[model samples]
Target chain A: MFAAAALALLVALILLVVRALKGPTVFDRLVAANSIGTEAILLLAVVGFLTGRPEFLDIGITYALLNLIGTLAVLKYFRFGDLSQSGGEEPEN
Target chain B: MEAVINMVLLTLLVVVTLGVVRLRNLFAVVILGSIYSFLMASVFIVLDAVDVAMTEASVGAGISTVLMLTVLSMTRVEEAKPAHSPLLPLFVASATAAILIYGTWDLPGFGLAQTPVNTHVGAAYLERSIADTGVPNVVTSVLASYRGFDTLGETAVVFTAGIGVLLLLRRGRSRARLKKRQEERT
Candidate 1:
């Protein structure tokens, strides 16, 4: 049962990869990338269960944190050319 | 089942690599690269290297993506067209890959317990790690206790690298404001 679920996740991952590759806009790619991160976390959990090592979920949690930070950083960079810049500050010259 | 997952993840990695190579838009390439890293981490998990998967997921998929995007924002979003023909590089890459594959032909079959690696310190560690470190997880014990100093050195190296990146990338608010005022006055 776990293996079947893993296979389904892989199928979803392939589709996500396609969208990331072929997306017309950068935002499209960003959405795809975010969904891919979610898929990866799920894949880690499912694979861990399949391997009978549920302890691997710790890594999944870490991945989740990193994914959230990474996405936010990217979005911030898109909004402000510099990551250090707060949006309330005057715009870049 | 494990092998099947590994193969599929590897295929996804290859497809993502092709996308990275084909795309001229730097932003899209960065996104594809993150996907590639996630696929690689999944592959590592399927191979039962959970520790490696974690590092790859955090560093490869997470930190590297932000770093590369920072670099992208600092430079052109679109890649410049190559000035030279790709033939030479292609030939070199193909030859290197062929040689590496040929070299691997001599490797022992996968998961053979009698392999030298399996019979070496790995076996000893497997046998003695728990007793030596009182840790249930062999990888954790090996990284944290058995090879504690080495891990410490690695941590120091990562720390120093982080410091270097921050020093390079950080722009002081005061400095920026000063520069802006100077520009305004001129």
Candidate 2:
């Protein structure tokens, strides 16, 4: 059953890769990349279970944190031209 | 099952890499590169190298993608066309890859206990690590105690790189401030 789930995740990954490569816009690619990260995290966890080494879930947790950070960083960079800049929405006192 | 997963991940890696190479848009290329790294980390996990997989996920997929995007923000997003044909480089790359694959043909099969790596020093390390360092994870004990100096060197290298980046960014900030002060004086 874990094997079947892992295979399904791999199939999802392939589909995500297709979206990423065929993207005509940067946002499309970005979304695909984010989804790919999600699929990868799932694959890692499922593979860990399949291998009977559930300890690999730690790596999955680490990956989840990194994926969140990376995706946010990219989105922030897209919105703000510079990473150092405070969000322009707030009026300075 | 492991073999099937490894093959799928490796194939995905190749596809993403090809996309990275063929795409001219830097942003899309960076995204594909991150995908490539994700697949690579999965491959490492399937191969039972959890620590390496963790490092790949954090460094390859996370930090490098951000770093590359920052670099792209500083420059034109479209890659410039090369002046020369890519044929020679392609031929060279293929030849190198072929040679590497040929070399691997003679290596022992994967996960064999009798392989030199498993039989030699690795066996000794595995046998002694828990007793020597009281670390449950053999990788942790090996990295922290038995091969402590190597790990220290790796840490020192990372520290040096971080300091170098900090110095460069500081210089750039100070220079900008100097320019602003000069403008104010005018």
Candidate 3:
């Protein structure tokens, strides 16, 4: 039963990949990538349970951190010409 | 009993995924994706993995959607429905799925007693982790104490990425401050 649930998530991951590949714009790509990252988090947990290794929770947490930072970096790049400039330092009002 | 729980979770996951694919509005897609994550988190909770569920709810549903929206603000929402046929993806995805299912043929059937993981350090850790680590969550114990070094490496990787992005995105610093000020005002 959990096996079936994991399969469903794997399918969702595939859809995220599709949305990412076929995105009409960078924003679409961003959303798709976010979904992919999310699905990966769940997959890590589910797979860990299948293997009965709690260590995989660590992997899930790490992936969560990576996913958040990566999304921010990408967003920063899109908003500013480069990553450092947009969310880096503050401008004087 | 467990079958019922897993089935419900799987159904929710699939439905929300389709929502992610079929939604015309970008905002709606983001919300749906979060729902998808929430469902996945619930599955983890049912498996008795509380730590993973907490992180998924926080990072997947909370931070992810917020960051996506920030990125969205920097660009235009795609108004048109993407219409690519899923021929290649369907083939590839189904093939991968089939392989996964086949691999599970050798796996223990839904929490049997004789699984190897239940006999190794895995079991020892689960049984004794509370006594060894001050933290009640075994997941945290394993990550912080038993595998602390590896976790550090992962943290460094995250820090490096953050610094890299910070380096690349700072466009003269002056305008960035301006944007923040504008946001605050708005």
Candidate 4:
């Protein structure tokens, strides 16, 4: 069952990769990259279950956190040109 | 089943690599690179290298994607076209790849117990790591205790990289602040 899930995840990953590679806009690629991160976290958890080692889920959690931070950081940097800058008062594009 | 998974993943990785190479948009390249790292992490998990998979997931998928995007924002999104023919680089890369493939011919089959890697200090580490460190995860024990210096060095390298990025990016802000203070004094 876990193997089946992993296989499905891999298929989804491949589709994401294709979208990332064929992007006509930066936003498309960014969305694809974020989805890829989400799929990777799922893959990690499913594989851990298959291996009977739940410790791998800890790594999955870490990846999930990092993925969120990374995506936000990239988007922030793109908008503000610096990560330290706050977006609160800035006019939206 | 494991072999099937490895094969499919490896094929997909190759496809992604080719896409990255063919793409000229920096944003797309960064996205593809992140996908590649995620695939690699999954491969490491399938190979039972959980520690390696974790590191790859953190550094490769997370940090590298952010770093590449940062660089992309700082520079032109479209890659500059080369004036020269690509033949030379293509030849060089192919030669290097061929040599690497040839070198791997001597490697023992995957997970073979009698392989040199599995037979040497690996045995001792597996046998003693739990008893010495009281850690169930042998990889953690080996990294934290047996290879303490190496891990420390890696941490130092990461720290230095963070500091370098901060310094490089923060200089403009500092300069702007100094100019503002100078204008106020004038």
Candidate 5:
């Protein structure tokens, strides 16, 4: 049952990767990439279980954090024309 | 039963990959991508790595989708056409896929008790982890204590990424000062 599920996810990941490659827009690719990272975390955990090595769970947690930060940073950079310009607080100008 | 399950999983992986590539709408694509992550997490569960499954579900299917969607709200989800052709990516991706598929052959058969990985330092850690670290989860013990230094390094790296993002996203002092001066003049 689990194997089948994992297969489904692997397929999704491959598709996402292609989308990332052929993204019609940068955001489309970013979305795809973000999804892929998410899938990979799951994949890591699943594989760890199948292999009977539980350490992968930690890696998954770390990966999740990194993925979120990376996605947010990318989005922030693309917005406001300048990443240097922070949101939420207005510049005196 | 296992064979049937593996076959099904493998088929889904392929189909989703194709769908992701073929889809035109960026929103739909993101949704599909999320589906893929969710499925992958399921696969991990089947593999018997419960801890891993938890992380995947939490991180992959949960946080990632939210982060991406948030990013989507800020930018154009769909991409415009590039001036150049895209044949190169297709060629590269397929070639890389072929190589990775071939590499899987060398991996130990799943769940083999005597596999080299289980025999070596892994066994030592597994055996001693509970007694030494007083942690029931060997994974946690190994990550936090046996190889604590490596974890520390990894944390530092993440911190650096956070710092880098903060610095990059932060307004320069000059810009802030200029704005302040402008306000005074006004």
Candidate 6:
């Protein structure tokens, strides 16, 4: 049922946290953080169903959008020294 | 079953916090912080605080991570080694935590109808929210209508944060442009 699925998701979240914590490279941590966001969205939707409140799904959708924007922004900032930098040419690192 | 879930989530949160504390790399710490926020959102949902959970998910997991990473990009990715010993701070933190946990010992059991919060204002809200505001979601009615001023203040805080970030990041661009213009003129 929902409880079982939630438990599984919790396990996955813990594993992701472990990966994030033990990452030897920055990209590894970033990937772990992205996966954690994905798991949170799923957790929110599943919890909404378990609680019989479908309205919570609206918040879940918002979280998903924010997650996407945040990951892309961080990646872009890392690639370019400035956030407002144009994507036309690569900056010498 | 719910209690079990809550306990499990809370334990994971503790583990994540410990990881954040032990990790010296700023990038790992930021990632762990995001994971911690995700765990907290789930805990909030299990407590039936859906609105709080939503805010935590968006602000804590989403915005805070991006902001922290942005800071990392501007600074050194690796944390500096501390010159001082950590024992004194550890002792102080442990004492504070112990006292705080002890302070919670006298709180009423969760969800008890006879508790002051449940019997007093909560009862009134549950009874009158539908009739007064015609909103089926009592939380929405309470936040948007009944507590209009408080919601407005929260919105203002978010607006201020957005403006602050824009000012901080955009200033560099303007300065660079000014330097280029001055050089060209010379």
Each model's TM-score?
Answer: 0.93, 0.88, 0.56, 0.88, 0.54, 0.89
Please say which candidate is ahead in DockQ: 1 or 3: 1
DockQ, all models: 0.77, 0.64, 0.08, 0.63, 0.12, 0.65
Please write out the lDDT profile of model 5 over residues B41-136, one tens digit for every residue.
556555655556556655555556555655565577675666777899889989999999999998889879999877878878877887899998
Tens digits of per-residue lDDT for model 4, A1-93: 888887888788778877887778888888888898888789778877877876768777777887788789778877876554445737233
Model 1: residues with Cα > 4 Å off, grouped in runs: A87-90, B172-174, B184-186
The sequence of per-residue lDDT tens digits that candidate 3 reaches over residues A1-93 is 657767787668656656654567667767776776677667666766765755657656766775676667556544653433434444332
Q: What is the TM-score of chain A alone in each candidate?
A: 0.90, 0.87, 0.85, 0.87, 0.83, 0.90
Identify the leading candidate in terms of lDDT: 1
Instruction: Please report how far candidate 1 places residue B172 from its true position, in Å.
Output: 6.0
Candidate with maximal TM-score = 1
Order the candidates by lDDT, highest first — what do you get?
1, 2, 6, 4, 3, 5
lDDT per residue (tens digit) for residues A12-78 in model 1: 9888888898899888888888888889889889988998888878777888897888889888888
**Residue B44 of candidate 5: its Cα lDDT?**
59
Q: Candidate 3 residues B103-175, lDDT tens each?
A: 9898887777677877768888988898888777677889999899999999899789767745544544557
The regions of model 4 sitting more than 4 angstroms off are: A82-93, B177-186
lDDT per residue (tens digit) for residues B82-147 in model 2: 999999999999999999999999999978888878877998888888889999889989989988
Error of 4 at B21 (Å): 1.6
Q: Is candidate 2 or candidate 5 better by DockQ?
A: 2
Q: Output the worst ten-in-a-row residue range by lDDT, candidate 1 chain B.
A: B167-176
Cα RMSD of all models vs. native, in order, equals 1.8, 2.9, 10.2, 2.7, 7.7, 2.3
Q: How many angstroms is residue A46 displaced in model 4 relative to the true structure, after the best TM-score fit? A: 1.0
Question: Where does model 1 sit among the CAPRI classes?
Answer: medium
